[model samples]
Target: MNRKEANQPSPISRRLFFSYAGTSALTATLVLSGCKDDESGMPVDMGVDLGSGDIGVLNYAYALEQLEAAFYTQVIQTKYSGITAEEEQILTDLRDHEVAHRDFFKAALGSAAIANLEVDFSKVDFTNRTSVLSTAKTFEDLGVSAYNGAGQLLTDPNLLLIAGKIVSVEARHAAAIRSLINPKSADFSGDDVVDTNGLDGQMLPDKVLMLASPFVKTKINASNLPTP
Candidate 1:
């Protein structure tokens, strides 16, 4: 759906669009369908040299999706109070999209994809509405910056296009959630999401995770992520 008519899901629900006809979900399922792998054995190598090409870019996307998926999954498992049905559905959709993103990269990358990241959400008060959304806002914004920053690093045109589509959707999500924070904040393109002079902001994976580390109790080593 277009942004104007985009249906807003409640804080508890997910507000995202998914097409079953698309193969991203299929690819994701295929990627995670095999035997379980250990995080220790696989290691959290954000800079695993994804192969010095598009493979690296795909792997990068996969890593971020893993984090996003983990966070949303936790949110749903321990839902907060004062959550509306609409919000619940939105969060669910958000969770599904993150899952699809995680799976999409996993399937697309095949063996190149990293292992599931164990997130630590000990700092987030799932019972508190503000804490949850604030962290959610950070994630959404980081995802947007990440795609924007990393998109240039992608060697393949098709992969770049795919990342564009996904980041656009993420920007929409960032906008919607900001509205809930404060109506005036809904224009995500404003200083909140964007930077001075209306330029898009950038955040390295390390910095992004450091911001996220507060809520996540899991120890992540993004030191290996490829850099420009």
Candidate 2:
């Protein structure tokens, strides 16, 4: 190979990305399996109960990841009108990240994972860049807040560490979408999402699910999730 070719970084395939992304959480799953609470008794009359304790939190994160992955997949498949090549690449990367995250949680949760969520994106106009990007911002912001809010509820150190890592990625996604919406502006880390304390906003499980209801067809019962 030429010197330039030898210096190039290896391209990462989706399969390899999934394996890398899921390895830590998958290992945590094995460690947690022996000590996690039994979920069979969780109430499901209202809908799918996220379960309880750390499992519930994992399910919650998994559900949101599923929604994001589905949205980005659609965005890439349809490609909003006037989408630049750079925008296409960014959106494609976001789609892959979200899918990897979804698969990671699913693999981590194993039999404890929630069912695949059915999302309704009828409100999103794929032909319109404004509509597509605005919707992406909403989902991305919500995901960041969801992770932040749920972080305190995690009891296991390993799970909490994993959640922290995922939330940071979610924050990056949120910032990227915000920048796309308002380039050269401070909207990416605007005061609306970042408070006076310089910390990102957070929303509890119930509140997060309520805000996410419109996009999700499947009913989620976060009633069983742990509180403060």
Candidate 3:
């Protein structure tokens, strides 16, 4: 294959995709009830209500995965100027992983899944490496924190296990992006994100959504999510 062809992003295998989908289907069957505004008993007219309980948490994750998948897809499609082969390969892998994750959550939520979110990446400059990587770092960090914070809200052990697995992957992605931004440095697990107790930072849903709002055009109503 030519260099250009070799650098092209590869699709995730059907076997792997189906494996995740199957797991998601089982989880959905076990956890979800009908999608409804549990608090108001009426559909949310202002925006998407992320439901309540475990279903709400799953939808929240699905939303973030959608954003990440879309961002990396755009980056790969319109690669930044001066992107090296290594960078291209890294980004391609990230894109594939995020897409898999996004679809996995969608499959898990089934009928309870939130509608496809409309994103606004207008602030991101795809042509600039710094702009892309910086945004990537922000997203990866936020994803890790989001899962960590939401974990306590999940009552089901199976769901908690799944969330744990996904958060570990998100943490890895955050580290990779951090390394890219500050190669061969301790910034990969910087004190900013990792505290004195050596634990990764966690953010509640409200704070996470607020920070993520700029990139998502869909007004998310996360009011019904369980509190700590």
Top-scoring candidate (lDDT):
3
- Candidate 3, residue 158: lDDT: 71
Clashes of each: 24, 0, 0
Residue 79, candidate 3: alpha-carbon lDDT: 98
Cα RMSD of predicted structure 2: 7.3
What is the clash tally of candidate 2? Answer: 0
lDDT of each: 0.65, 0.80, 0.82
Error of 3 at 128 (Å): 0.0
* Model 2 lDDT tens row, 1-228: 111121122233224434444444333321211222348865434666677777788889989999998998899889988999889878888887887788777766777777878899999999999999999999999999999999999877767877888899999999999999999998999998999999999999889999999999987877777899
| TM-score, model 2 to reference | 0.82
Worst 10 residues of 3 by lDDT: 1-10
Residue pair clashes in candidate 2: none
Q: Any runs in candidate 2 off by more than 4 Å, and if so which?
A: 1-45
Q: Order the candidate numbers by lDDT, best to worst.
A: 3, 2, 1
lDDT of 3 by residue, 7-81 (tens): 233244334444443444334422222344658687645578787878788888989999999999899989999
Which regions in candidate 3 have their CA more than 4 angstroms from the true location? 1-45
Candidate with more favorable, higher TM-score: 1 or 3: 3
Better of 2 and 3 by TM-score: 3
Largest TM-score belongs to which candidate? 3
lDDT of model 2 at residue 147?
97
Deviation (Å) of 126 in candidate 3? 0.2
